[model samples]
Target: MSAPSPAQADTPRSTGFLLLFALANAGGVIGYLPLLSILLPARIDAIAGDARLDLFTITVIAGAAAASLSNIAFGWLSDRSGGRRRWVAFGLALTAAAYAAVALATTPVAIVLAIVAFQIAINALLAPFLAIMADEIPDSQKGVAGGLLAFAAPVASAFSAMLVLSPFTDTTRLLLIPAAAALCVLPMLRTKPRLLAIQTVEKTLSPPRELAIAWGSRLLIQISGAVLSLYSFYYFQSLGTRPDLAARVAQVLTIAYVLALPIAVLSGRVSDRIGRRKPFLLAAAFTAALGLTGMAATRDFGMAALCFGLFQIGSAVFLALHSAFATQLLPNPQHRGRDLGLLNLTNTLPSLLGPLLAWTLATPQDFGAVMLVLAALAICGGLVILFIRED
Candidate 1:
């Protein structure tokens, strides 16, 4: 592979493109976070009652499978089609329809099927949407772009809080959430980006080995994330708080990510200037592990919340920077969409693995064992990254 031309390497994207791109990604977050974090489990519990945990596990597993396949398929398809916006628009429509299905589902079976459909539709949107970042944004800007990606968490979390605190019924909340996501997505649809193309006479570097290592590391870290995303509300309730209070606690935890925004942006900028990603990645991983260890040892609500906040900050920074790092590692520019979809396996696989771990090691009343185990996995993940020699 040839090195990027001087002009390509030096040019930066406009602020307008970056902002709209960030909002588009935020739309993806808004579409799913509230559903998975708050609404899905609540709906399953309502219908499943005593078997809520079992049903929730099943739903997540099914959804994960669908997400895994759909992301790869859509990504490859987008690569073949030579465009992204149409696919994204089509995905957004499908996602909206799927959300409506979820809202109307009243039985366990119906809910699970709806969730599976939702997963497929959403991944279709996300797969190409993510590839767009790699396709358009210059490498010089990816770190800052990744930092901006952190904005999604707070935006989505705020939406979740609003849904929880609102007087609307679950059905109404379900419809409203996706509607907001669609609005966020619309602006980017109007703009087109100049796609970067890579020309190579022969491969110059070993990318597969490095990508595999990075994939494994992300999978390990994301397992902890999946567990928390699916179970944090329950974990809070297990601490003896009432349902409403637990919801508030989860929302308060959003503050961690909010604070992480500046840290991530600054770290990204520094990494861009210094051209180093591993140190920040390693530090963030260990910081998250430390927070998890703290959470495992503490039972007090206040202390636990603080520890979780710490974990959030670390994980948020790691994920944001990792995005930039991973894009730089893509082996073939032509297959970026497909390659990124492959990378997304790290995200989806955790949903399957995390649920299994939580099921085996945790109960409705206790999550300490799972936290300790997750901390260990996080440590291992950080260690794996050490083997990747930066280019």
Candidate 2:
């Protein structure tokens, strides 16, 4: 560990900053979730018809590749420039513009191009924004911060349900989602928190090895998340759900995430207090695996929904705690932005792997095989974390 830089030593603690930071995370989720999970699929189905899956796969792969590269680039750029706020604001503007382009797209090719642009813009926003947490939030508070971060999913999911259920036109909905994100983000942007007060600490585990293990664990887990996020709408349809019930499905997703909120917050707080994260992380992984396994074995819509809720609870808690754990393992404070960007690959790379897995094992009507595979991966992710000798 190293001494705090002068700027870092000047940082102040404020509940307002944490609240705004969580809201900003929700804003980021809003920026992408509704678009990727609902709107984009709907658009592709409208334009590509029976071939929507093929087009969706292509578009997602392209977007993921763009995101993978752009995240690292923007993170490094923010690090070099010694600022994250301006880059994030610029990325938000670009994201809005890209959304407009996506709305105006009339063909598959055009949609793919627009999605690639959107991915780049969104990652530019996400990479720097995440780095801000590592740069400022104290280790003692990171668990609570990660717990707060869990709020983003339900907020975004609820917004997705609203967009689907409302009588608003697709174009109007597209416009409104980004505006809602801006409202969440703007408050954080307006309030500048002072830098973090970094302190030297004895190492418990080698940072490089711990980070590598954490990265791999997250990548394995996220493959399932990426697959589910992109395919849940289709999955519900496969359960013999009426086409008009998309909003209902979105509502179910919202409820699942909402149910996970308290558990995530409570577990995170407990982990912080106990100075232990692995137990919660392990429990979350196995719980998610159980849910996915149950989902694979059942075809009943009600049962599947219940299982999905269980999975959401597990995934949410895992992500929240793992985030705090990983931040502590970051090897270099000075390069926190860039290192976190590298970690972002665990997120983006899954988009690629997930599609490949889905294309190979799943059809428009059958997702059971893919679900089982995902369950196995989640278990493996949990097992991988055991290799790390960290608290």
Candidate 3:
């Protein structure tokens, strides 16, 4: 292992810094997701004809494989090097290049390759950045930081929708703009040397069993959410039978997430004050289950939107706290980047499972069965969390 560079050492923390950091991470994530969630499926249909679903599934499978490998590998490297800024900077630069590649892709194979590259680069960006969170944030306030981080998805989704609806219809601009936004926050990552006497000590390491239980619980809920999110545009298209209307419905669904952002942030803050994570996480799971069930039972777009909004609120709460709690559960503070990388398996695993589950259970006309499966998973996620002893 190389000696610690001056840049790898611990830096001073501030509220403003955390905010900007979260924003940058969110921007980078949104850069690809909107295209993934909104544009890619339709684009595949245009390029590949009747095999669009197969192409979408294959691409996601490949991307998932890439994400899983890259996250853990880069995380291990970051922990060993004790650095975040350089890796993030490199990731942002690589992500920009990958997005440009996506913009130029003319075939399904080309698009899939681009997507894989993007996923790898994005994971590289996220793994190191998340490690920085584990390194810097105190346990008492991690929920607050997690809440701020949770805002990234909704905000990015909403922004993506707006871009789609705008006159800038070029895929190049759509991809590049968010890439630029991601890089804009790079200055926030500047680090200073660690002071040897200062140590973060509020939270003890959680038991391995407890951490595993929490991981399982969170993984199921994340899979459920992934199923809903990845197929939302297609689901709406089936309902309306008009591409434009489906896009509009997808936009509305994303707005629900944006509206729920406050609830997510508040839930984290409240959880911090109460000093409890299990209850909020449990409620999040149950709420998502209810929403998934409601969506399955409803035919009306309005009703479905309401249901999905509920799910969004619940999911946001769960994910925000999961971030904080997962960080606390790390067995080795020195290896936090690598450990969190393992925890991130929960996130990437769903990209594989969610799509496969949807392909097996739901056709374009029969999302109800898939929704039921998702609801069941959400319920199970909540139930599993009961096994964890917080102490």
Q: Of the candidates shown, which would achieve the greatest lDDT relative to the real structure?
A: 2
1-391 per-residue lDDT for model 1 (tens digits)? 1122222544788889888998998899999999999888888888998899999999999999999999999999998986688889999999999999999999988999999999999998999999988777877888999999988988898888888888999999999987999999989888855665443211333468888888988988899999988998778777885747736764765677688888888888899888889999999999999989998898888888889888888888889888988887888777888999999999999999999999999998899999999999999888888898885
* RMSD to true structure for each model, in Å: 3.1, 2.9, 3.2
lDDT of 2 by residue, 289-365 (tens): 99999888888888999999999999999999999899888887778789898999999999999999999999888
What TM-score does model 2 achieve against the real structure?
0.95
Clashing pairs in 3: none
- TM-scores, all candidates, are 0.96, 0.95, 0.92
lDDT tens digits, residue span 248-267, model 3: 86577678778778887888
Model 1 regions lying over 4 Å from their true place: 1-7, 200-206
Candidate 1, residue 103: Cα displacement in angstroms equals: 0.6
lDDT for each candidate structure: 0.87, 0.88, 0.78
Q: What ranges in model 2 sit over 4 Å off?
A: 1-12, 198-206
